[model samples]
Target chain A: MEKNNNHDRFFRELLSDSSREMPFSDFEDEVMAEIRMEYEKKFSGRRNIRLSWLFFILGMLSGIATVFVMSFYSANQPFAFISDNLLPVGIVFICLTIILFAEKLVKISFRRDNH
Target chain B: MDELYIKKVLDGDIDAFRYFVHQYKDKAYNLAFSVLKNEFDARDAVQEAYIIAFRKLGKFRGRSKFSTWFFRIVINEALKSSKKAGKEKYIADTRTESVDPGHVEINDIVSRDQQKYYIDLAMQNIPSKEALALTLFYIEEYSVEEIREITGWTESNTKVLLHRARKSMYHELNVLLSTEKKTLY
Candidate 1:
């Protein structure tokens, strides 16, 4: 639904053509390998997206586990709620939500600065 | 991930570089061909693009996908190569060139009609930047936002360029195509 026009179709075709695929040749392999090697060294200074996604996935798993444990405790220990992990889980949810929101601050540049 | 090969290279292997070269040279060349439309320039442009990308790989934060960043680098290289080579020329010499049935060969692919191939050809003789803009938007199908990133134009600027570029392509393409179709074919 987002892209349902001739132009969209046109762009799709064009995008497919733009990929860096070519006939197999010794030269092609050499260039790809060379660039990859060169980048791996230079990209060492910062955690690349691949590495960042790894951490994000770990965070997601931890948060999921935390939520599950806290939810079970809240339902089972309805009377001794203070001892339940619910509060901590709630706090974690709030904190992590804010942190994720904060990470999106830079992306707001695409927004029209109405000022 | 080239995985084991990357591991060896990281461990200070020089032969690994050769393997790297073996892997992506043709891909890089094809990228050039897509944009520059010339085999010789595309080959050189890809080689040059790879070298520049290699040199600046440290700066690549992977804010975008790896291939997207690499594509940007190659596009820049092709643009630069076009400038040095001057406007590219096109020929419709019906002499034993490959063509698919019902797919008209417009010298300039941006022309409105598929009839006059020369119109597309004429586009090749114009400014490389404009030509590239048309090709990217129409042929490569990059979004205006994506074009903004690739060409370093703001969103509004990209929109304006695309509008003007399309108009120009249509005008140029029609000049050759429309009249011929009405009179000749």
Candidate 2:
């Protein structure tokens, strides 16, 4: 038992002596750079989502404004084709907006869950 | 303290992660070296591990100490590197052999100047798992339970590995010293 203890102590001392110092001085910096890159990628993804939403909102508002303005035009006006198809056009626009919004929301929620 | 830094990193404070990198780098390097046995490979493994930890930091549930979790990543990365370099077969072959210690005197053979060199050589000769077990048990002074936690091994398996590791380490040291003795005389 005593011999085993001595051997254990000796091995411990030897192992401690063999413990090495890291050679690379810039190790932390290298790791941090990679981490920063990942952070930037995530930040850019979020920015892209925000930009998409901004464009979507702008497009939706412009569609509504165009329809509203066309409503005041006579049937013989140059935009009569648009006014004649306004209701169906509005329905299709609303459905498409809802689908795009739902897709964006799903993607954001999926990313959040992954993180 | 680690939790605080983890929270800061998760909160998008990228600089806060430097604290962890500085704190664990050396110890993590040593652990990586124990498995890979090459300075450059060990360093690359540790760097990769740190990047992995950072990328996966959000999934950290704080169930274990940050060091334990990080060390596990370091070991896995080192093991993967060793496997890629075709060194895993060499490490695996060393584990099954039992060496007879004979009558070698460790203290008489190892001089102060050569102590670190011979010990490192012996560690390199042993199986990587045994080397890792010895480093965590002796150098790091972690309990068997803690080792089990870090390694995801069962309690009995951890104990058995430690026992075999100690025996293999002593045998390897004896062989190294005996070779040195023959070379000297």
Candidate 3:
């Protein structure tokens, strides 16, 4: 139809017209900043993981060394001594629990922050 | 040109990736805008797409032009954002009428400026896929093969989409302009 032709001509003209440039200045800087920040965040996460693993290994070794030293000192009755000092033993157990949970808490917080 | 930046990026130079982003920002924004019809969403989509492309750079494999690979990412992000924003409702409503230019009524002396406005408005209403294809074709002057690459559609599918888009845009513009005239006069 004539109307269709008219409309097609109009569309052709509209499309043929040059589009205005996107109104963004310093977009590259913003994106670069974001990418940089992302890398830093990733690097920090990996560093934290390594640190956590190192701390874990160190804690396990210290625990083993404390047991060895305690057994050597109380070779005659290590179990009886430990039972006799339930308060100190309980405190040590609590501290270990706190440390383990604190590490887990930090990991959870990091995951939350990233997401 | 972009391949050089991509290579540099692959070599662990993060800053070099900026060159590719700077080069394609405008075209990417335009393509996103063509689908989203919202400036802020389009901008966000481009940014997110670029970040995704940067992270996924290792998988690029150089099988296609960097531009094509980048464009596919941008268009996919824009579509996801568009869907999330519920703009697809407008597109669906506008796509109802099969382009029947015979139904249009155009006065002989319509202004170019007016036509341009209606054209833009109509563009916002068409199906997102068609609008995206037409945008790439007209604004970027991309070849059909390039559009096919960008859209991940077959060559025949891309051509058919463009044809449908052209017809749909023509009819939508006529209808929109006629409605505007009725309201104005």
DockQ of each: 0.12, 0.54, 0.26
Candidate 2's residue-wise lDDT over B107-179, tens digit each?
5776777877877788888778888888888888888899888888888987777778777776777767768
For model 3, the stretches where C-alpha displacement exceeds 4 angstroms are: A1-13, A18-20, A70-74, A78-115, B90-108, B154-157, B179-185
Top candidate by TM-score:
2
In the range B47-150, model 3's lDDT, one tens digit per residue, is 99988888788778889998899999999999999889877634344444465554444444366776667667877878888888888877787888888888
- Cα lDDT tens digits, model 1, B1-185, are 54455456546564564554555565555546645777677777777676675565445565775456766788788877766776444433322232221233243344334432453454454345556666666655567887777667788877765555444444454455555666655
- Supply candidate 1's per-residue lDDT for B23: 59
Candidate number with greatest lDDT: 2
Higher lDDT: candidate 2 or 3? Answer: 2
Global CA lDDT computed for model 1: 0.56
Per-model TM-score on C-alpha atoms: 0.48, 0.78, 0.74
| TM-score, cand. 2 vs. native | 0.78
Candidate 2 local lDDT, A42-70, one digit each (tens): 77877877787788778777877766666
Q: What is the lDDT of residue B75 in candidate 2?
A: 91
Docking class of 3: acceptable
Whichever of 1 and 2 has more TM-score, that candidate is 2
Q: How does the DockQ of candidate 3 come out? A: 0.26
